[model samples]
Target: MATAGKAVVAQQQTNLPFAYRQYSAAELKEALRKMYLIRRFEEGAEDAYMRGLIHGTMHLSIGQEASAVGICMPLSEDDQITSTHRGHGHCIAKGADVKRMFAEFFGKTTGYCKGRGGSMHIADVAKGNLGANGIVAGGIPIAVGAALSAKKLRTGKVVVSFFGDGANNEGAFHEALNMASIWSLPVVFVCENNGYGMSTSIERSTAVRSVADRAAAYGMPGVVVDGNNFSAVAEASQAALARARRGEGPTLIESKTYRYRGHSKSDRNRYRTKEEIEDWMTNRDPIALFEAELVELGIIDQAGIEAVREAVRKEIVEGIEFAKESPMPDMADRERYVYTEAA
Candidate 1:
C-alpha cells in the first residue's frame, strides 16, 4: 500500500505544470500580477496617447502578455534582455518601473532615458533591460554582443533577445544566431510570432512554416509554445535557461502569440479580419487563460484576482499622474546627452 501511494504521489507531481511544480504560490501570484500590470499599462498608455498627453505613437502588446512574463520568469535580476519596438510588456516583465515608462512616453526628464528614448528606446541598464530598439532586428546583434561579453567575463548571465517574426528573415538575425551558436553564447532568441509584422502576415513573408524550424540551421534547440499559455512558455523558458546556464549553445523560442491591437497606433489593421481578432481576444486572452489556470490550481480565488486587478488599476493611475506632473527636458540641455562629455 505504501509503495502504491508513493507511485500515485509521484504521478500527481509529474502531472502538475512546470510553473506550478517549480514555483511557489507566491511566485505564481506575482507572475499573474505582472501580466495584469503589462495589460493595464498598455491600455493606460493608449488612453494617454488619445488624450494628447503622450506625443509620439506607441506599439501596445495588449494580448501577448504571457510570452513576455513567462520568458522572463526564470531569469534573474542580473540577467539581460533586448526588446523590440513592441516592447512594453518585455520592459514590465523585466522589472521596469511603470511610472518611469509613462514618463518616457510623456518625454519627461524623469523617464528611463531621461526623455530621450521615448516609446521604442526605453532602457533600464541597472535592471538589465539593455533597451528596446526601433529598427528591425537591431537589438539581435546587440544581445549577441552582450552574451559574448557574459561568456568572456564568466558572468554566468543569460541574455534574451525579443524580436517580432518579421525580423526572422533579416540578415542580422541569421548572422547573430550563427555567431551565438558557434561561440556557444548564453543567449535565447525569442521570436514573438504575432501573425502580422506591420501589415504582412508571416505566411506572406517567410518561407518557413514556423520560426523555430530555423533554429536547426544554427545548431540549437528550437522550441514552440502556445504563447497564450503561461505554463507552456514558462516550461520552455525554464528548460532553455537551464541549457544556457550549463554552457550549451543558445536556444530559439518561437512564441505563437497574437496582438489584439494593430501593429502600431498608425496601423489601419486592414490586413487581418475582425473575426480573427475577436476570436483571439475572447477565447485566448493570455491574462484570462492564466487566471483560469491559477484558479483551477487553487493558487488564487476570484477575490484575490480582483484584488490584483484593483492594484494594477491604482498603479496605472498613479503612474500616469506621475508622468503628467514630471518636468520635461530643458531646452538648454538638448545637446547634453547627444555627445560624450569630456572628463
Candidate 2:
C-alpha cells in the first residue's frame, strides 16, 4: 500500500481529452468496501421500512451506487455537495457518518438535523453536506449558491450538484448553470440518468439523447459515459472537477445508468418493462463489471473481494446498533429546524 496521505492510483482510458489516475490495490479494495456498504445499508433500510419500522416515504438509490461513489471519492473536506431525495448514497459516499444517517432515518436525536429532517432532509454541514432536497431540482439553486459563495470568498473549494435527468428541465437547473457559467464558478453537475422520471422514460421526456450534450449550449464541455462503469465515471468526474478547480466553470456529465427498483416506496412502476429492467441488471451491472476488470488487471483476488464484503457488513451492523441505541427526538420539538429558532 502507498503512504496514508498519498492519492490512490486510478485507471481511466476514455477517449476524452483528459486522463485520470489509477487506483492501487488498497484503494480499489477500500472503494469497493464503501460501495458495498452503501448497497447493504439501503437494502436494510428497505427491509426495515417494508416491515413497518420506518415512517415517511422512502426513495431508494439501490442500483445507482456507481455515480455517487465515483464522483464523491474525489471531493475534499472543504468541498460542498447538494443532493436530491434519492440521496442516501450520495451522503454515504461523501463520508457522512453512517450512524448519524441511520439515526436520522429512525428520527433519533443523534442525526444530522437532531432528528428533525428525517430521511430526505438529512445533512452534516461540517462535513460539507449541504443537505438533500425532496423537491425536484430544489437543491440545484442551493448548490449554485454554495459555488457562488466559494467564488466570492475565494475559498478555492468546489461544489457538486447531484441530480437526476428529470431535474434538467427545471428552472433552477438552467438558471444555476447560467450563473455558474457567467461567473465561472466551481461546480460539477452530475445527472444520474436512471432512464425514467417517475413513470416517464427519458426518450419521451428528454429531447436531447445525451444530457451532457446540453453542456455545449452553456459554453462548457459535455461528456457522457456508462454510469455503471465506475472507472469511466471516476475519470469523467475527475476531469470535470479539475476544470472546476481551475476556475473554468461547471461541466455537465450525464451518467448512462438504470435503477433496479421503482422511483420511491409508493411507486408501482407499471410504465417500464420487466425485460428492460432485467437487461440492465444482467448485462449492464456496474459493480459486477468493475470487479471483473479488477480481477483481470490483477488488482485483487477473490479473498480480497470477500474481505471487502465482510468489512462492509460489519460496519453496517455497527451503524444499525448505533441507530437502535439512539434516543428519538422530543415530540415537543417537532417544529424545530423548519425555520429560524426563536431568540
Candidate 3:
C-alpha cells in the first residue's frame, strides 16, 4: 500500500477516484449503498435535531463515510469496534438498524440503551460494537480491555478503536496504547484526523505532523491513509487487522479525513474559511468520489446511482416515522437502567 501522502498524490495524478479492483460490481454497489445510507441517515438525524425531535446535540459524520465503511467492510461480524462521538457512520456501517438508531435519537423506549444513551452513547453489544463514547479518547481503554479479554479467552477476534486526532493528545490514548503494545493485544487504533479537534485546527494543538508517527514508539507499524479514498482506508485496515489477529500486537492507522459539518450544532465554524470547506465538499467528498469512480469504471450507471439514492431516501423516511411512532421511556422506568440495582 502507498503511504498517505503518496496515495493522495497518486489519486490526484491518475485522476482516478478509487482503487477498488478487488471489489466485485455487486460489492461496490453495496458499498455505495452503505455510504448513501450513512449520508442520508446523518442528514435526517440533523433535521430531527433541528426540529426538537432529537433530545440532545449530535455530531454528524457527513463527509467521513468512507473512513467508517471502508474500515469495517473487511472485518467479520464477530470482530469488534469502539467508536467516537462522531460515530453514527461507524454504527451504521457496522450493521446498526437505522430504525432503532432513529428511535434512540428520538429517545424512545425501544431504542438502543432503552433510549438512555442518546446520540453519543449508542452501543450494540450483539453487533460487537462496544459503544460510542462521549468523552475524548474514552473508548480507547475500553477497546484495549476488550482486546485483552479476547486474547485471554483465545477468541481469535480483533478489536478496532476509532478516535479523532484530538483524542490522540489525551492521556487515555497513551496509556491504552502502552498497555496494548506491551501485552500484544489484538487491537487496531484508528485515528480519524479530520484536520481539527473541535474548533481548533490540528496544527495548533498537535506537535507532530502526523498522528501515525507516534505508533513507532509502541513498536507497531504506523500507517497513514487517504481517508477520503475508500480503497486506501480498506487496504490499510486489512493490514492492521491481519497483524492484530496474528498476535503480533496493535497497529495505529491514521485516516486523514475531514468533516463537513461544524464540530457540533453550536459551532458557527468561525475557525475555518468557507473556501476550505467548499474545497473539501465539492472536490474531495468521499461519496462523490466513489460515485464517480463507480460510474467511470462501468460498475454503476447514473440510473443505478439514482436507484440507490431513492432507496436510501425511503429508508430514512421510514426510520424517522418509526422513531416518531415509538414510545418514550416512562417516568417509573427512568432509574431502571441508569444504575445497577441490588441484584
Candidate 4:
C-alpha cells in the first residue's frame, strides 16, 4: 500500500532534519496514523461547522495532533487525562468514541456530556478522561488533584494534563507546577507550543523561548521536541510517563507544533500570514513526515497510508449521518444535569 503522503526521502541521506531518538519503523508508522486520523476528524468537523451542521464554537486542531496522541498512547486504560478546549485529538487518542463525540457537538441526548457541554466540554470519566475545559488553564489544577488522588489511592495511575502555549502564562500553570513538584505527584505536563496562544503570538506572551525550559524552575525534566514529528513526541512522552509512574515526579514536555486553522471557528484567521501557514502545510505536516520515515524504512507504501485516510474519512462521514439522525435531548430534560430544585 502506498502512503497518502508520499515523499522521496533517500535512505542514505546524511543530514537529518530534526532531533529525535531512533525508533522502529512500526512505531513511527502507528503514531503517524493516529495523528493523521485526528487531523482528518478535525477537518471534517470544520467542514460540518461551515455548513451549519454543528452548533457552537469549535477549536479545530488542524495541527497539534502529534502532541495529543504522542502523550496519550503511553497511558494505561486506568490512567487519567485532563484536556483543553481544543481537545478532540486528546479525547480520540485516549480511545474516546467518535460517534458520541459527534453526538455531543450536535447536542444530542447520547452525548458524552449528555447534550449540554457541547464541543469545548466533552468528558468521559469512565475512560479516565476528566474533561476538556473551556477556561484557559482551568484543567491544570484539576489534573493535579487527580494525580494527588491517584497517589493517595495507590492507584499507580498517572495523569496527563494537556494545555496550550498560552496556558503556560497563566497563574494556575505556575501554581499547579509548584504544587505538583512539592508533592511529587504523578502528572505529566504536556505543553503544546503551537506558536500562538489563541490569537497572540508566543513571542509577545512570554520571555522564555520554550515552555519546557520553565520545567527547570520546578526541578523536572523540561524537554522540547518537534511536535510535527510523532516519533519524537511519542518517545519524549514515554520518558515523561515513565518518570511519573516511578514516582520520580513530573516532566514538562513542550511539543513545538503548529495549528493550520484559526483560533476558533469564527475569527477568519486574520492574525497569521498565508506564507507561514503554507510553510507548515507543505513541508511540516506530521503525516508527511511519518510517510517519509515509512518509505525510508521500507515498512509501508503510499497506498497503505491512503487506505488509512479513506477508512477514517468513511467513519467521519458515517458519524455525521449518525449525529444528524440522533434525536436532540428533550427540552424538558435540559435543566436536569447542572442543578436540582430545593427539597
Highest TM-score scorer = 1
Candidate 2 lDDT (Cα, 0 to 1):
0.83
RMSD of each: 3.8, 2.9, 4.8, 5.3
Poorly placed runs, candidate 2 (over 4 Å): 1-20, 338-343
C-alpha lDDT score of every prediction, in listed order? 0.93, 0.83, 0.89, 0.84
lDDT of 3: 0.89
List candidate 3 stretches off by more than 4 Å. Answer: 1-19, 339-343
Worst 10 residues of 4 by lDDT: 1-10
The residue pairs found clashing in candidate 3 are none
Clashes by residue pair, model 2: 9-22, 9-23, 10-21, 10-22, 10-23, 11-22
User: Runs in model 4 with CA error above 4 Å?
Assistant: 1-30, 339-343
Error of 2 at 255 (Å): 0.9
Error of 1 at 33 (Å): 0.5
Worst 10 residues of 3 by lDDT: 1-10
| Residue pairs in candidate 1 whose N, alpha carbon or C atoms collide under 3 angstroms | none
Residue 269 error for model 4, in Å?
2.8
Show model 1 residue runs off by greater than 4 Å.
1-12
TM-score per model over all chains: 0.96, 0.93, 0.93, 0.90
Query: Tens digit of lDDT per residue, candidate 3, span 255-274?
Result: 99999999999999999999
Q: Ranking under lDDT, best-scoring first?
A: 1, 3, 4, 2
lDDT of 2 by residue, 121-221 (tens): 97888889999998999998889899999999999999999999899888888888888888898999999999888888889988888888888888888
